[model samples]
Each structure stands twice: as C-alpha cells, then as structure tokens.
Target: MNTVTPVRFDNVNVGDALPALDLPPLSRLTLALYCGASGDHNPIHVDLDFAKEAGMPDVFAHGMLSMAWLGRALTDWVPQSALRDFNVRFAAITHVGESIRCTGTVTEKFEHDGERLVRVSLATTNEAGVQKLLGEAVLSLP
Candidate 1:
C-alpha cells in the first residue's frame, strides 16, 4: 500500500497541487486481487501468455486500476465532503511489475449558475518517469 498524503485543505481552490504519491513495485498478487475486486477479467491483465498473444510481452495492470490509484489520491486530498465529479483518461498500459506514481495540480476554480467547480490537471507515470496516462477532474465544491 502507498502512504496517503498528509496535506489537508479546507475550502480548497483551483491552482493548488495535491501532493505526489509513490508506491512500491506492483506485485503479481496485488494485480490478481485487483482483477477480482474490480470485476475486470481481461486476460491481458492476468495471463502473460494471453498478453503475449495480444502483442504485449506480459500481463499488465488494468488502466482503470491505475486510475483508481489516482482517484484514491484525489479522495484523500478532498475527502468525500466536497467532491462531486471525477473522471480520467487512460493513455498507456502499465505492466504488473512496474511501480506507479500519481500527481495532480489544480488549474481552475470558478462558478456558473450558482455552482462552483474546480478543474485539476492530473497524471500517472511509471518508475522510469514515463507518463503513462494524463487526465483532468472537475471537482464540485460544497
């Protein structure tokens, strides 16, 4: 498991960056467990043979699994009280043996129609520092 950020915020606004998250190398068992827990049965994520057949050298973690890590980071920073929208884009595949790091920086905070929205820039990368995915989130503040 990764350590959650200790940074706390009240009435967080745009242009604020959440603390970065770093985790140890991903374990095969962890990937298996995630597959079961998330109900994602893609063979490419579990069986290396199937992965090779699918043009990959070995099995990799699900894209959504990585996204879940990103979500965890966000939820930790914002808690459940002020968040109303969360979304991400999958940009590349992550193999089971690699470690992943999550990060995000707030980019915008504004209001329209009596609603307040905070836009954030986010991303994930491998241990080698290669960005595997990129995305953004619109957080509705309470």
Candidate 2:
C-alpha cells in the first residue's frame, strides 16, 4: 500500500505548493452516480435534453462534485483534521469526458491560538487549462 508522509508544520512554509492531483475523467455514468449519491438529481446534470433546452450544449457536471474532488485532493495531501476551512466558487461548467486537475499554492502561514496554519489558493482546471473552480482554503498543521 502507498503511504503518505505527513506534512509537518515546521517543514511547511508560505509559498510552498501542494503537488497537483488529476481526478478520473468525468463520464455520463460518473455524473449519474454523483447525482444518485449526492441526491442532487438536478436534470441539468443528467439530462442532455433538459440541458440543451436550458441553452447548454449537453448535460454537465454538478459544481459540488468538482468541489468534492477538490476536497478529496486536499484531504489526500494532508489529514482531513488539518483542514480548517475550504470554499470555492464555480468558475465554469465541466463537461463530461473532461479530465480535471486540482492544484494549490500556499499563500500564507502563521501561528494562531498555538496552532500553525496555512492559507492556500486552490483551483481546478480542465485538460485545456480552463479554470473550473477558484477558491482558497485554510489548514491547521501539526
């Protein structure tokens, strides 16, 4: 099994970027599964006809699913307990069959309430490098 070396607070510094992670390519089945699991069965995410009627070329992925993938990338890098806050804004729609890459750069670091914390600028991009999500996160480190 692959093991992750925990990131130590002392070893991390402002401007240190976490390695980029690429999620599996999004497919129609993936969208359908997300709709089922999240209970966000919005037709826009699973119905091509509904989406086209809504002026979109085809059904697209839910923004929350991309956000969840971003969260997955973060938690994979550091233990979930290290996450203090994470928020994102949907920048663009992610279409099916597109691969997404999640990346983050540490923007700042400080000690608060005896805890060493870091702020990171996070983003997800499509294979063509189009930004899909934009946001920031705060993490508590050990």
Candidate 3:
C-alpha cells in the first residue's frame, strides 16, 4: 500500500496548492467495477441501452465515483485521519472516456478547541475543463 506523508498544520498556508491527481480516462470496465464495488448497480452508469432509453447519449460515470476521486486526491495529500469533514456538490456529468483532474487549495487555517485545522477547497474537472464536482474539506492537522 502506498503511504501518504501527513501534512503538518504549521507547514500549510492559505492559498497553497495541494498536489493534483490526474486520473486515467473513465472506461466501461471502470464503471462496471465501480458499480459492483459501490453496490449502486445503476444501469445509467453501466448500460448504454438503458442510458439511451433514458434519453442520455451513453452511460456515464456515477457522481459518487467522481466525488470519490476528489476524496482520493485529498487523502493523497494528507493523512486520512486528518479529515474532519468532507462534502461535495455534483456540478455536471462525467461521460465515458473522459479523464478527470482533481485539484485542491488550502483556503483557511485556524485553531479551534485547541486543535489546529485547515479548510480546503476541492474540485474535479474533465479534460475539457468542465467542472464535474466541487466541494470542501476540513482537516485537523498535527
């Protein structure tokens, strides 16, 4: 398993950019595996016929899948134990064959209840730069 170096509160500054994660293009197999692992089994994400019948051009990636990518990006930068709160809003659909890029920036840093904390703004965008997810995370750092 890959290990992440925990980010220290004192080392982070507002407006600092976290390392970006560029994921490979979303494939049909990836969608299928995600469906199985997530227990979503949503045909709209795996069945092209179902998606077409539903008026969509083709099967697309699940919203949670994209959000999960952003979460991975966050955890890749800091230890998972540092996360205190995480939330996201789905802004657009991610179509099959599209690559995603996850990025984050430290937005604020403060101390609360004797704990040092930082707020991070997160986003995921397609290769065309269309945003698919937007969110924030709060981390209690050592």
lDDT of 2 by residue, 60-142 (tens): 99999999988887887788888989999999999998999999998998889998998999999999999999999999987
Task: Give candidate 2 regions above 4 Å deviation.
Answer: 1-3
Worst 10 residues of 3 by lDDT: 1-10
Cα misplacement distance, residue 23 of candidate 1 (Å): 2.0
The TM-score between candidate 3 and the true structure equals: 0.95
lDDT of candidate 1 at residue 116, scale 0 to 100: 74
Name every residue pair that clashes in candidate 1: none
Ranked by lDDT from best down, the candidates are 3, 2, 1
User: What is the C-alpha lDDT profile of model 3 across 19-97, one tens digit per residue?
Assistant: 8999998899999999999999989999999999999999999999988888888878877888899999999999989
Decide which is better by TM-score, 2 or 3. Answer: 3
Worst 10 residues of 1 by lDDT: 1-10
Error of 2 at 142 (Å): 1.0
